[model samples]
Target: MANNKSAKKRILTNERNRLQNRFYKSSVRTLTKMFLNSLEIYKTTRTPENKEKVQNTLNSAYSLIDKATKKNVFHKNTAARKKSKLAAQFKTA
Candidate 1:
């Protein structure tokens, strides 16, 4: 338990930040999954439309990752690593 007003306020603030961070992290994961799925579809189908879809999802995932990094939810190195992996997968496909 918090012993003082400031401590209590800090606890509340921390909880709020935790929730926001969790939302960003989960959203990033979801977007990454969507990107991978689209990439898989593109690999199997080899259609221009599927390639475009993959590109769109990749862009969205990259955007979210950058935003999360900017918000301090993700470290810049972590964000860069994730983006690199995604890009590598895209290139290989």
Candidate 2:
């Protein structure tokens, strides 16, 4: 428990930051899933429209992952790994 005023304030601030981080993290995951699903659809069709959708998915996924890394929610290496995997999936799709 926080006894001092400053400590109580710190606890509140931490809670707020935690919620914000959680939101960002969940959003990232959701975007990533959307990208993956788009890629899967692109795999079967291979039309220009599907390709454009795949590209957009890749771009959005990259942006969110990079943002998460920048905010320190994910490690730089972890982000790199994820980006690489996404790229590989895109290529094969």
Candidate 3:
């Protein structure tokens, strides 16, 4: 247990930051999955609307990933690698 006032406050702050980090990480994963799913749909259907959806998904994923990196939830190169892999998936699909 935290015996001092500062230590208690630190514990609370850590919990808050942990929750915030969790949110950003979950957002990154959700956005990435959304992009991949949209890509799969585009592959199967090959329609303009599906293509547009895929593009939008990719854009949103990129934005969220960059935000996560900026927030220090992810490293810069890790973000770049993730973005590259996502784009690669899109290309191969």
Candidate 4:
């Protein structure tokens, strides 16, 4: 238990932030998975449709990661690393 009022408020704020961070983390994971799946499909099918889909997925994932980084949910360097890895995957495929 928090002995002080400010400490109690801090605990409440921390809990809220934790929940919000969890949501962002989950969303990021889902978006990354979607992008990876698109890349895999593109690799196997090699169709123009798949290419476009993969590109769109990659762009969306990148955008979301940037947002997360801006919100402090993710570190800037971590976001950059993820974006770079995604771009490399697209390039290789």
TM-score of 3: 0.93
Ranking by TM-score: 1, 3, 4, 2
Alpha-carbon deviation at 85 in model 3, angstroms: 0.6
C-alpha-based local distance difference test score of model 3: 0.91
In candidate 3, the residue pairs with backbone N, CA or C atoms under 3 Å apart (3 or more residues apart, or in different chains) clash, namely none
Model 3 over residues 1-93: C-alpha lDDT tens digits? 999999999999999989989998899899988888888788889999999999999998899889989889899999999999998998888
Cα RMSD, each candidate: 0.7, 1.2, 1.0, 1.0
What is the lDDT, from 0 to 100, of the residue 1 in candidate 4?
90
Expressed as tens digits, the lDDT of each residue in 1-93 for candidate 2 is 989999999999899889878977898788889988888888878899988988997898899889988888889999999899988887776
Q: Which segments of candidate 2 are over 4 A away from where they belong?
A: none
Give the Cα error of residue 81 in candidate 2, in Å.
1.3
TM-score of each: 0.96, 0.90, 0.93, 0.92
- List ranges where model 4 is wrong by over 4 Å: none
Q: Give the better candidate number (2 or 3) by TM-score.
A: 3
Candidate 2 — which pairs collide? Answer: none
Estimate, for each residue in 11-90, the C-alpha lDDT of model 1 and write its tens digit.
99999999999999999999989988888889889999999999999999999999999999999999999999999999
Number of the top candidate by lDDT? 1
* Alpha carbon lDDT of each predicted model: 0.94, 0.87, 0.91, 0.90
| lDDT against true structure, model 4 | 0.90
Clashes of each: 0, 0, 0, 0
Better of 1 and 3 by TM-score: 1
